[model samples]
Target: MSQTPNRSYADIRKALLAGEETALLDVREEAPFAEAHPLFAANIPLSKLELEVYARIPRRDTRVTVYDAGEGLAERAAHKLRDLGYVDVALLEGGLEGWRAAGGELFKDVNVPSKAFGELVESERHTPSLAAEEVKALLDAKADVVVLDARRFDEYQTMSIPTGVSVPGAELVLRVAEIAPNPATRVIVNCAGRTRSIIGTQSLVNAGIPNPVAALRNGTIGWTLAGQQLDHGQARRFSEVSEVTRRQAAEAARAVADKAGVGRASLAQLGAWQAETARTTYLFDVRTPEEYEAGHLPGARSVPGGQLVQETDHVASVRGARLVLADDDGVRANMSASWLAQMGWEVHVLDDVPASTFTQAGPWQAPLPALPATEEITPQTLADWLQEGDARVLDFTASANHVKRHIPGAWWALRGQLAEALARVPAASRYVLTCGSSLLARFAVAEVKATTGRDVYLLAGGTAAWVAAGLPVEEGEQHLASPRIDRYRRPYEGTDNPREAMQGYLDWEFGLVEQLGRDSTHGFFVI
Candidate 1:
């Protein structure tokens, strides 16, 4: 096989500076990729490269530079990209260490671009914020204040400020008028950490809403550190907006987007862009999951506005690609596009589209490469094989899922590391492959067969099917064939993270504005 060509950090930086289409991919698991990487390097782990690459970098000839932290995953990923028909693939000249050696600033945490942008917004806009203690006192006093949790509904349900209502970031501008109709009512926004809080609060401030808005300083992290009690299992959510409120929100959001230089695109223009084979264009439905599932524009991926801003790399890996955001509610898409435009994206809000035009219904489906057909076995058949000791079960599900619940005697394996995993598992006459839904496992059947020179069969419907058949299962890490590095644990996510880690995370965020200043490649400009 031909070795992948190397691209220097200087070359990548030049492209970014010039707003050229490029994909700086960190071909490592989410866990390690979050630790340290270049500012624009998107985490596209080698383990799930096939699953994510096509959807993320749609243009086959887009410039792609893969790198790793000396794990030797980059070359393998580069070769795989070539096999998958990605025409312009190369390796980072120095990998992670080389970036450091070349004096490029390495950022910590996933979604560094968004986090840094939040810090920049706070610094430039001076977004107001009240500490946890102040907000708690206001809640205790029954003051005319509303606490809005700007995280996802599930995260808000897990833990929230007492009296806090779940109004995710994008929904805030649209729902706040209804939630706090009185102009004197104080509105407070918060997230698990800081970024969303700043962005959400700033969204209202930018929109020129009548209410006095402020972010919950440091968000729930500060609330926990302040030794305050949080409401758990809370079900509070934003109510439906009246037509009056929706119109007001639409007007305000459009003004903000205009000020931020966001473009307005008609459906016809979007179609023209989609038809252009030379450029990559991503169509996203920037609405809540339920709203997206109900209906959305054809070819649009469901990426909630809040998360689309928070994790741009995950949603739009092809840097410099044209982006079109759609929302039945004008507020979310416009607000999201405003931020995206400031972050140097060529972004547009789909204009004047009626809800009925969203003819497509159901969840967004990722584009995948064609899979090879392989022999399949029913849950009962696989169970019988296990009982007869004629087959070894190799699970290609996420490590965390395997540890939580898996088929009895199944060894957790990574599809990308199949050869290594196959060597670890005890040899059998045949191997049964399964994942949560068998999506990934289906892609690995041919590779496993070639590796072991034995019959390989896929578990129809995967482990989910097994459980549905009332089959017994066991859980533990005793059968791990690959190490667990697929996901990085965020210190601010769960309730039990050590205090030091939380503080360290906050400290890192506090320094991101300075880091952005040092890097100077981000084309961010706050409105």
Candidate 2:
């Protein structure tokens, strides 16, 4: 977060324009990263540095530049990279503000590159779409048209067109025929924004679905802009696919995947890829998070196919890494692979694998790595500190989690703005930090200690440990010290976003293709 001699935005632009390999990183949380950032900047927040960096940016000596919006997080992140043996790490001169000052454009939302690529797909392939007015007329007339919302379940529940059922992009080809068995029935695919709708509609066309299909142009944004009513609290989801439907969907998806040059890998082939230590191999299960949580292949992380395509950089930061996707139904994996392959990743769909291969079940969370140097205080010790009133408790976990439950009397603070918030707080002799797992609190220890010149300690296992120890805790948004700016409030995320905000969001997405042209750093290719 401190200023130092590092590469300017111009330097980064020169390298990108020259086709040189570079990793321009934004060392911040996803929310702010989604609010505004460079088109090609990969976000690897400081809290997850140890957990994700090695796999994402594998080569230690690879040229890397880190930046933050003067938040003081970047310098520590750069140091962590060096400690991990990265020899060519530096800060971005002027951070986000500097980039703007130098006439570099900032884009909103996660996965801008993938979204831009989707726009490119539509530009080249001429994916067809219908205006909100036209779709509204069909719904009013009760035409035999099935509308599919190609977004995550929660997103669909937020706001959707009338009579639209949830059928995420990955499931479009797999479930379209089942939804519209009559060949004469019309089909409509839509999402919160443009990318998923366009890509989902195109997937149905590429898979050769029986029904005539089109996207709800510009998605919910366009619907709202056109003064069309949107349904909220919708719960309808796609029905279970029959064996016949599954077979048909697999054949349809596979043909498109083959045409897109996506590879088909066996479990043995995936094992071979995993054995290559020098290469980064990401194994993902492209199914709904609920399905993944119920049962999934061992070592395969849950990244639903639709979200994976929309957020490729978020899941796999290493551009050239080998990606192997798995899904019990096969269609989602294959369809997702087709898009990823064109995005310039060496992607494969695991084929002919039985459900028996998914021996692991229940909820899965990534294991937390140990944080050295910082002393950890047990829950019992923290209880005594609370009773004695000598230590100030600060919870660095998400506000949503804090609202559910946190240590009694602990003030919630954003990790990136801890220093700024500490200045306004009543200084304590001892400062103790806690989060859901305490992994993030460990990263904050040094910064808090430096800023306050007080003793700092991490809650051994975080709030979860405190609960496990049967300690009393408070519930609700109590004792808050910082605002929840860690993440941006997405217009398509909740049930209550204003129509104007939604329209503005659509306007932002509409201009991304032009922004992509200006940046010209993203190495995206559409098939």
Per-candidate TM equals: 0.98, 0.86
**lDDT per residue as tens, model 2, 1-527:** 34335998888888766555567889998888988899878998875687678656765666789999887889988887888887888899889999999989898888888888888888888999999999999999999998999998988987888999999889888888778999999999999879999999999888898788999998887787788888999999998878998998998888888988999899999999878755667888998888888888888888889999998887676555678999987799999999988876778999888988888887656643455679899999999988998999888888888988989888888766676678667789999999998887887899899898999999998999999999998898757788776666777666467978888877777777788778776666666
**Model 2 lDDT on a 0 to 1 scale:** 0.84
Model 1 CA lDDT for position 513: 94
RMSD of 1: 1.3
Evaluate all candidate structures by whole-model CA lDDT and list the values in order: 0.92, 0.84
Cand. 1 Cα-lDDT: 0.92
Best by lDDT: 1
